[model samples]
Target: MDLSETNQTAYRHPWELSRMEILLKELEKLNIRGEVLDIGCGDGYFDKEIIKKFPLITNIWGVDIHAERCVHQGKEHYVNSYNELQKDKKSLILF
Candidate 1:
């Protein structure tokens, strides 16, 4: 995960997810496009933030293995398989 680093942006602390300038900048760049999909979007809270930050995201897809996690979050689907995601071009995003 972005919050934890292991040769892959391992944050020394979880709070660092918000403190990292580079990450924020990268997010800003992507947000400007206002169209991003977060696959395997766990709780989808981050997805909601991405939509909020961008606002241009006309379509947001938040898929996860646990339907409980996607409950009533306005998430399109809470399916459990990667194949189920391929139905959309946004499926390019994978965990």
Candidate 2:
């Protein structure tokens, strides 16, 4: 159901879930491997969703400019800046 139709507090947003689903499908088709990095990963919501659907991608990382803006609902290797991540390797970076 839509959040507007429910009396309970929203745990997930429909739009976000839809976007994740599309991304998940595309990623699955690619048969991706290695690390995944989420930039400006607010609250790590998408990270949790991705991790839940793609457990094989264990090396996931999240980076946000301000640490305070992030929420750690799931266990993620969060960093304060993109500079903290490796510059040499290609990564699946999401904005």
Candidate 3:
């Protein structure tokens, strides 16, 4: 699916929207609570999505190869590599 160059929120592939909801629901059902490090987090979009759905997550951090594409909605931090975030052992890694 191709997203519009102007606004990503205005356009999304079906899988992009559905998968995020499914993942969030599964995470909630599992009742996982801890700092979360999202790997390959493009623009931190899903980071915002998960945090919005699961308030139990104490800390949210995002890592991606393309640092220029990273985005944050709240206190979330975006890094370029897993090694940067892996220095802290407290986070629950997600891909």
Candidate 4:
């Protein structure tokens, strides 16, 4: 039931993931869209839902430690150890 394990593509804790998926589908019905950034996106399971449910999203980015604890194939979103996330006009969605 641990879908968040190893990128098998399921929610980490099971029910928590299921509920979020249902909610995201409902939001899609309202015509909402934008870039999505999944920080600490552990296994990027939620990111998968965002990509499938939200077609309006033009880009998807996720960041996590390069280890088994957080290994997900993302678009290479890495900030230098000294780098800071500067907030500009762009949107930022964190979970």
Candidate 5:
């Protein structure tokens, strides 16, 4: 399937929406306030949503094997591997 089509499907799927809702609820409970590292972040869609919902997040980064697919406001926000991301900063990691 086309990547664009897959993204459209994910947005439209009830199960996928519900899953994201649940994940967001869980994240809300944490009251996280810091950087976030999303591993295997495809297209960085969830990362965008996360930052939008949680303004306390100072920064958000995406790590994906297919780095070219990651869509972020800034290119530096996406990396090809965890090792490429700065290790010193404390961040909430999402899979």
Candidate 6:
């Protein structure tokens, strides 16, 4: 099924769930630390779950065209563009 047809909530569809699981496993292999940049993040549901599973992650920022749809408040957690994220040059994992 096309992802565009899925529900607004992240990880609701079977494909989404499977993709997230794969991402998590890949992350485990990398043993990543520091921040994360979630491009095209919808409402940050997956970001919340990612943080829970990875204690080493200091922060997770969501960037999406539909920034208003982001549940997270403040620029610290959500931004409309990549340029906004340039303020911080910390190590980041893009997901």
How accurate locally is residue 8 in candidate 5, as Cα lDDT from 0 to 100? Answer: 42
Candidate 2: residue pairs that collide: none
What's the distance in Å from true for residue 77, model 3?
2.9
Candidate 2 regions off by >4 Å? 1-10, 71-76
Q: Native-vs-model 1 lDDT?
A: 0.53
Clashing pairs in 6: none
Order of the predicted models by lDDT, top scorer first: 5, 6, 3, 2, 4, 1
The runs of at least 3 residues in candidate 3 whose Cα sits more than 4 Å from the true structure, single-residue gaps closed, are 1-6, 71-86
RMSD of 4: 4.2
Worst 10 residues of 3 by lDDT: 1-10
Flag regions of model 5 displaced more than 4 Å: 1-11, 71-73, 79-81
lDDT (tens digit, per residue) of candidate 3 on 8-69: 55665677788877887788777767788776777667777777777778877776666666
Candidates 2 and 3 compared by TM-score, better number: 3
Per-residue lDDT of candidate 5, residues 1-95 (tens digit): 23355654345456556767999999999998899887777776677788899999998877776767774444866555567777767558898
lDDT of 6: 0.70
Clash count in backbone of candidate 3 = 0
lDDT at 49, model 6: 74
Candidate 2, residue 85: the lDDT equals 66
Ranked candidates, highest TM-score first: 5, 3, 6, 2, 4, 1
| Candidate 5 weakest lDDT stretch, 10 residues | 1-10
Model 1 lDDT tens row, 1-95: 54223232232455544644454466666544433456566555566656666655665667666656666675355456556654544522424
Which stretch of 10 consecutive residues in model 1 shows the poorest summed lDDT? Answer: 2-11
TM-score, structure 6 vs. true: 0.72
All candidates' lDDT scores? 0.53, 0.65, 0.67, 0.57, 0.73, 0.70
Name the runs in model 6 displaced over 4 angstroms. 1-11, 72-81
Cα displacement (angstroms), candidate 5, residue 90, comes to: 2.7
